[model samples]
Target: MTETAAEATGTAAPGTTAEPRTTAELAPGVVIPLIGLGTWPMAGGEATGAVARAIANGYRHIDTAENYNNEEAVGEGIRRSGIDRGDLFLTTKFNRQWHGRTAVREAFGAATRRLGTEYLDLFLIHWPNPSQGRFVEAAEGLTRLAEEGLIRCWGVSNFKPAHLRELQAAGLEVPVNQVQIDPETQQPDQLAFHRGHGIVTAAYSPLGRNGSFLSAPVVTGPGAEYDRTPAQVVLRWQVQSGRVAIPKSADDRRQRENLDVFGFALTEAEMAGIDALDTGAPPRLDSDEFGH
Candidate 1:
């Protein structure tokens, strides 16, 4: 939760530029790093600086959304870092309010314009719209974007296993599915299904919003002998599972930590203990769409 938390993990800030290492290929053309930088609750100038610093310090993947209201800053950060648009993989989500055939195309266009990118690395349906029940319509817009070469890949956020089935049935391949996954609530069922069809899991709030992991004894407790925080452990779990974890931070140090998952490994025993904590924390972000 604090900016200083990441620095404690043994990574420092932008003294030199850092390059990204590819982990799992979300799709044939989309590769998401094991660790990605997240910019939510990182607003305005802070979000802007975080993006730039993340890139300068070696972060290649950034996760953002229209709901975050900071794409322009994210764009500025990309511009300032001078990292090639191709080398950096960026992701953003559409607002749930804009999820219909009537609005999907324009909303997608608006998001691209705001991010200042001609083609997005990935675009997600931010949340499910139950009332509309028009995932197919929205998927059509996404397919159009992909066909037009405006976005390389497309997916959804906060979708459950059943919802994933529905989207797949809609005839759109959901490449990257973003959700709030962490040590306390690792979505094995959801992740298994996603992997079964080659869909990538992009985790949001991977730190449990600093709520679940920090509360767990394994992370913030006497078990700290491993010299890693609950957040880092959860992040490590995400990486070990072949899921893309995006940890957010506005502070220089945490941003570095979010990007610093490459140098360590967790034992299978430790991973099992963490996996035991999965309690399926009651649809914190995307239940409405699941009903559709």
Candidate 2:
């Protein structure tokens, strides 16, 4: 049976949440929750505890990376959550050093060991380090892993249109691309390119740091109309607009709040209002010059 947005967003347990009911299919049988818990700038017991807390609150999709230096902690949280590994979607990324065809496999092995998982749901090439010029080879390696059943699917992160074009020219299939996107720094041209290529775009840092539009009436108006928080309104606008959002929050209440967005949606006008807040500023990090 198909699940309704409201049904999917409902918390599965009292004071606990269910996975986001809504999802974006990256490949056949490979679905990603529209809203995921982002684990960046978090580590050690703090990372482990936050991840466990999120799971207890019904967050089924978790995002982390080797660069985050918290995979072991994230893995610990997963064990503590006690949720079946099959029921949750875990995603992580590899760094530039592992940008070789075979090196990508080594990276995957190391990630699984630290994450304490047999296989990953989705793995990403953290950045397309153009100067190193091995991201394509890395992509090839990830694809091989997927074929061998090591990972469910693979894609790239921080890859701009030019980078993606190069991958395409090499005949690589990019199932997903995670990048920094928010209402304030929306990348229209980049998004258009993804749409044209059938690549799913997942937004990391989905909420701009202290986004100016959070208080704008366009957003607040909808929050009032829907009896939701400004952040919820923004997130609702995000998922409704067809982009996956991974907003980070270690606070229990905030994590729950972020997951609760699927219960309500914004109107066309309200969405457009938020979309108009784009400052046309470039992303915080330029993939061309910055990556590790």
Candidate 3:
């Protein structure tokens, strides 16, 4: 594993901006950016502008999903950024309605067309609808897509350790696992499980969506000491703790501020402080019962 951006750079210099950096490698050719722009509950022109602005401000990774209903806007934003397709790492998910082998292929095609790209940097199954009992079939579909060169890598979201083990038992390989992770919903066990399996854990809602976690002294004290916002402190904790964080912000200033986390390093004590804030309960929807 490579050193995190903060670990490599020491402390951030005042008024200095750092380049986007990769925090983990999913495979031989697939390197995931430490921070990515998460697009959910954002759509149409708003999503387009936010994505374009984020890319212009040094965000190379963009995470969207079929259920987000903004693939077109995301694609347009990528176009507006004027950055080459090869330089960006784009990820989108297959809708739950599109499970099973055939549906997976169809959904992927539609997503690529909406995303306006020939191939996706990474693609995922948005949810594991276990009740449907088609996740394995969907995984097989994604495998075919990968072998067909339609997607560079494939994985799952909202998957528990047992769910991952199930897929593994089916002889499938998952490179990434996107899940809701935050100080309040720490998921240390899940993180450990992913690391044990060589899977990259992508954290959604890393800042706790309701913004309540920002008030924790563990977060605020670190922000005050580092001259960073609570959001920055939380995102920094994610990167430093070795997880890919996709924080959603439509404002250009906030987007730029979020990407600026690489300038400083969080102390072991501070990291432990934040770790102590975990309530051990997930902040949002539970995967097993969700999207069923």
Best by lDDT: 2
Q: On residues 1-292, what C-alpha lDDT tens digit does candidate 2 reach at each position?
A: 1222223343333222345458767777787898999999899999999999999999989999999999999999999989999999999999999999999989999999999999999999998999999999999999899999999989899999999999988899788889889888999999888877778788898878977778999988888877788888888777777778899999999999999886665655777899999889889999999999
Q: Which candidate model has the greater TM-score, 1 or 3? A: 3
Q: Candidate 1's residue-wise lDDT over 142-215, tens digit each?
A: 87887778788788888777777787787767777788787667767887787677676777777775474565
* Residue pairs in collision within model 3: 12-263
Q: In terms of TM-score, how similar is model 1 to the real structure?
A: 0.84
Candidate 2 residue pairs in backbone clash: 17-57, 17-58
lDDT of 1 at 37: 86
Q: Count backbone overlaps in model 3.
A: 1
lDDT of 2: 0.86
Model 1 CA deviation exceeding 4 Å by range? 1-21, 215-217, 220-226, 289-292
Cα lDDT tens digits for candidate 3, 56-139: 999999999988999999999999999999999999998778889889889888998999999998989988988888898899
User: Least lDDT summed over 10 consecutive residues: which range in candidate 1?
Assistant: 1-10
Model 2 residue 99 lDDT score = 97
Ranking by TM-score: 2, 3, 1
